[model samples]
Target chain A: MNSRKCLAFEIVANPAAVDALCARAETWLIEGGLGTESFPVAMLLRESLNNSMLHGSGGDPTAQIRCHLQRGRKWLKITVEDDGPGFDWATRLECRADIENCHGRGLEIYRLYADAVDFNRRGNRVSLRRRIAEVMTS
Target chain B: MTTVQVQKNDATVTLEGALTVALAQELRPQLQKAVAEGVSSVVFDLGRADVVDSSGIGLLIATHNSLKTKGGRLRVANASPEIMNLFKAMRLDRHFSVEGRQA
Candidate 1:
């Protein structure tokens, strides 16, 4: 969180802003010479942003979700927090596997893209970190 | 999200839309019917499929797994690098045959 080149954007609880946030992050990854990782990064960004917008609203946008993105030496760390009562991460995880499931696929997509995922204080916030480099096997 | 291209011999099930939770419910049955009878193969053209959230992709993957066990095969064609990267991220590219094509 305290790096000379660390940049943060206060993402609004809007699905529209997700695209803009993704474009910004992709630029950074490309400039950082991690261009190959952009696709997964974009997916990760979209999923988390949508989750915050949907969950942070609490069935209501009076509540705002805060998304923080930081660039580490070898990984890009993203933390999304909602100002609401958090739920259990395990229960949500189980829903993603069911094809007939209705919701919570956004977080599941995030888990697929990120190298490591952790839930804090129930599910009010999530911390995700993904490696900047991945080898392509043709 | 569901593209139906009726060919001379069979029909191709091409999907080029968002396959999130909202879309998957309607999509699964469409694919199931495409190859219901004695058709050739259902080529899932993901060329223009932009956002394939985990649920939609999972449905296809699970279908692919099941089809293979029942003497059938699912072929995925025309996936953009961006979309294919999704498969790469989940290490699912190893499970299916992805044919990248031009627009």
Candidate 2:
């Protein structure tokens, strides 16, 4: 059986911290033997984590957001948790129905890129899972 | 990791390299200024863009919206297959006038 490995990170809810988070996630994906899935994974992670910090936490630099990346033989799991009050994801979904709209595409991007997405009761935490081979082929 | 070179006409911006969050931030102000100055018929040349995330897409949409409000148009060119797939998944092709669609 192939061993599964997981990595975690804590970041401030500032937009400037996005680069660092993405860099670390890329490194993790590369080192974990999922290099082919790196691009899409990075994109999905950027959107999810950015939304958590930017919208959920209202870009509060003082707030903390936790991120986790897990790699298995055939699956990859990502989770992002924020400390801000959550909103109605259903309403957000409706707002993104307009493709020409400038805003409200973050979560939609997450849905498009990730194989599966889940939000907690408060909607402040998100979990994304993707099949490694499926992502690579896509 | 994006480099923007404005054409002599000031109507075309050639963006090179990845359009990540940090790079998108850097390009946002320059584009906003161009749109504000009444630069119409802008072309965002993405032939060399290797990666683009939500931030990059958001910036593109904002630029398109800004241009349209000024009676101008925004066109994207030379997007890679991977990028095209991303745009297709997000239905961004309908929002931005991409040069070609191959996906």
Estimate candidate 1's alpha-carbon lDDT, on a 0 to 1 scale: 0.65
TM-score for each of the candidates: 0.62, 0.82
* Residue-level lDDT tens digits of model 1 in B1-103: 5767756435566776555544555667765665455444556777767666655675667556555555666677888877776666555567667776675
**Candidate 2 CA-lDDT value:** 0.75
Off by over 4 Å in 2: A1-4, A134-138, B1-9, B21-26, B99-103
Global fold similarity of model 2 (TM-score): 0.82
Rate residue B81 of model 2 by lDDT.
77
Per-residue alpha-carbon lDDT of model 1 for A43-110, expressed as tens digits?
77667666666665674444577777777667778787877677577767555443333344566676
User: Clashing residue pairs in candidate 2, if any?
Assistant: none
iRMS of each prediction: 5.0, 1.8
* Residues B1-103, model 2: lDDT tens digits: 3445555435666767667666778888988987786677778778777667777887888888888788878888888877778787877778768864344
Evaluate all candidate structures by whole-model CA lDDT and list the values in order.
Answer: 0.65, 0.75
